[model samples]
Target: MDLLDFARGPAINVAMAVLVFGVLWRLFALLFLGKPVDRTIPRLGTPGPFWAGLREIGRRMLPHPTFATAERFAFFNGWVFHVGLAIVVFGFRPHILFIKNLTGLSWPALPSGVIYAVGAITALSLIAALVKRITSPVQRFISTFDDYFTWVVTIAPVLTGLAAVGHVGARYETLLAIHILSIAVLLIWLPFGKLFHAFLVFLSRGQTGAFLARRGV
Candidate 1:
């Protein structure tokens, strides 16, 4: 098969399958891992554990005033990148069509121009975050190969997508193929790498808050 056909057809199909299977496997493993059940009685006068967990998830999504001055830039850029990336991924016409094909549901898509704008913003924010990771002493000290690998896999689709949209350095078809291939790589990488945090973040936050509430903290 040609590059475009392979990318959009067999390669993407395999990537999707791997993504689904890997994520399910990881989640089940987490479920079955033998952790002792919490036996502590929940504190009276506190929100119930479930509500506390949900509340904490929402609360931690925004920057707290205590750390706002120090982490405001990181928080802002991270939010922009995530929100913009979501829009670019899910709000494009082709992507909406793809989802419809998979799930037999369709949603209205934003204009192509709006998608391109969100893609641009996501790309810029991702680049800035990468730069900060490399340049900041503390961040660099904590960086590892996996961190950089995750960043590359995370950003490749955005870069190639923007390139495809702009018709840069190649035919639009070629760039689109590259973009699809990059996304395939991302799908495969996600369940096995730090990107899994996107799925696990809520679980982790909920567990923490639940535990704290049970202990009357």
Candidate 2:
């Protein structure tokens, strides 16, 4: 098959398989790590672990005041791109159709104009995120190769999706194929990279919350 055919067909299928299995593997491994029994009875009036964990999930969405000043930029920037990405991914007509085809699920799409605008904003936010990461002395000092690589993988689909829509640098067919390929690459890399935090962050935050609540912290 041609590049476009290969990208849309086998490559995407394989990537999806990897994403599903990789995520399941990680989750199961974490589960099998075995929760430690807390001998300390929860302080009187404290919520149970499940409730405390749920509460913590919401609490950790915002920065603690002590670190808010330092974290505010990243937090806001992350929200902008994250929201924009979600809109573009779930609100675009073509993407909705793809979802329907894959899982027999579909939703109404936003206008093409809205999708385009949101996609552009998402790409710009991603660029700002990269700039922030590289320019911040503390963050840059602590950053590893994984940080930058994951960033690239995360942003590739966004950039390519915009490019495909705008028909930038290539014919529409070619641009579309490249966009699909970028998405495939993202799916393949996600579970193996820092992006896996997308799944783990809530779990970790919840566990911490439960632990602290049990101790009456």
Off-target runs (Cα >4 Å) in candidate 2 are none
Q: State every prediction's TM-score relative to the real structure.
A: 0.95, 0.96
Q: Write the per-residue lDDT of candidate 1 for residues 1-217, one digit (tens) a residue.
A: 8899999899999999999999999999998897797776778888887988998899899988999998988999999999998998889999889889899888889999999988988988999999999889999999999899999998899999989989999999999999999999999999999999988999999878877877777
The Cα local distance difference test for each model comes to 0.91, 0.90
How well does candidate 2 score on lDDT at residue 93?
95
TM-score of model 1 (CA atoms):
0.95
Task: Give one digit per residue, the lDDT tens place, for model 2 in 42-76.
Answer: 79999998999999999878888899998999999
lDDT, candidate 1, equals 0.91
